[model samples]
Target: MSMDDQVFKRQGFGTDVDLVPPFGLLLVDFVNGFADPGVFGGGNITSAIASSQPLLDYARRCGWPVAHSRIVFADDGADHNIFSRKVPGMLTLREDSHASAIVPELAPIAGELVVRKTVPSAFFGTTLAAWLTQRSVSTLLVAGCVTSGCVRASVVDAMSLGFTPLVVADCVGDRAIAPHDASLFDMQQKYAMVMDRQAALELCDQAAPGN
Candidate 1:
């Protein structure tokens, strides 16, 4: 076995969590800025977004509750936080800024929840948790950008709030491959169930009505 696998096995980590429905999908920070390599994009982010297109379609077909998050600060920088301090460019993602807007291809439709926040975790200081809870969402499928940052943070918070977070591996990316892989491993080992798009779709198919 791989060294990491051996270690995790001995330490009793990486347990398989069952995928339960009513499912919800949380897409974090797949905004214009993150999709532009000249801005905050690089690595496999573009491909991740491409792969997520089908996953998003699958979720909609299954009639799952969907939520998306964008990092939007006040136009006057009044809502600046430690996140922006570390990356001052975050302040540029103001309300009217195109950089903070969700990519048109994956944009939210009428009933999808679009959450605006200045923090990494979507659930922190946001109505995402209650929104999911009210919809009886027992499992949350996550797909988005910067796997090492906002995606990781959101997954942990989703678990903390008692939702089974199924992180679609191929649908999440980071600016750097190393951090992206590391974060995926860490999340799989601890907080969430990490699997690729096909596996996730299979689970959803199996859980569908009359299946």
Candidate 2:
């Protein structure tokens, strides 16, 4: 076995998590800013977005509760936080800025929740957890950009909130490949169930209603 495998095995990490019913979809920061390489985009983010289109379609077909998150700051910058201070460019993602708008392909339809936040975790200072819980979402299928950042943060918080997080590996991306791969492994070993889009879909199909 590889050293990494040996370590995880000895530590009893990377346990399998069964796919549960009442699944919800959380699309984080799949906005225009993260899609443009000249801005906060790079690596496989564009490819990830493309891959997520079908996943979104599947979620809609399954009638899963879908929620999307965007990093939007106040237009006047009055609501800027430490996150914006750390990455000054984040302040540009104002309420009406095109950069903070969800990309068209996976745009949320009527009835889907849209969460606006300035921090990494969607649940932080937001009603995302309560929203998911209200819909009886036991398992959350996660797809988004910057696997190392907002996606990871949301997955960790989802687990902490007693929700099973199933991260679609190919449907989440980072500006750098190393962090993307590393974050996926870490999440699989600790916070969430990490799988590719096809495998996730198969599991979803196998899950019975009210399971």
Candidate 3:
């Protein structure tokens, strides 16, 4: 382990959370804008988006309840918030805007919830927690864009609301590499279980109900 990791471990952090049954996957803000570098995408975001496809497919094959979130504001910008004010461009991701649409690669199929939020946390003002609760989802597998921003926000909320969140590292990206790596490390140390795309899903496969 790195010297920093040894220190963190001595401080009684970075405990590994077991990936248990009844898993659900939440893909946060993998929208078109975040996928296009010119718009909001860059760094490893493209590969992250590409990696999530298999995760989604695996979730489908395993019959796990899946949900996707998009940052959608009202057409007239009536739903503006601190998030929008900070990044005013977020307000442009209105109801029917192409930029706000979840990319076609990870599109939510029928029977999956499509969460729309005006802020960072998907479970903040949305029915995400309730919806996942209704589906009996005890552990949530997370994948999406801008790891330091929306992904971290949603992971924290997921943990606070009594759900075990497993962040699929390779499947979550950011416009900035440093923040992306830092968020993964922080989330690993504190809020959630962090694993690479293959490792996380493989654990899920091993621990999945009836396996």
Per-residue alpha-carbon lDDT of candidate 2 for residues 44-70, written as tens digits (9 for 90 to 100): 999999999999999998898999999
Per-candidate alpha-carbon RMSD to the true structure: 0.8, 1.2, 0.9
**What lDDT does each candidate get?**
0.94, 0.94, 0.93
- Number of clashes recorded per candidate: 0, 0, 0
Would you list the rank order by lDDT, best first? 2, 1, 3
RMSD of 1: 0.8
Model 3 residue 103 CA deviation in Å: 0.4
Local lDDT at 7 for model 3: 89
Candidate 1 has an lDDT of 0.94
Ten contiguous residues minimizing lDDT sum, candidate 3 = 201-210
Off by over 4 Å in 2: none
Error (Å) of candidate 3 at residue 70 is 0.2
Off by over 4 Å in 3: none
Each prediction's TM-score against the native? 0.98, 0.97, 0.97
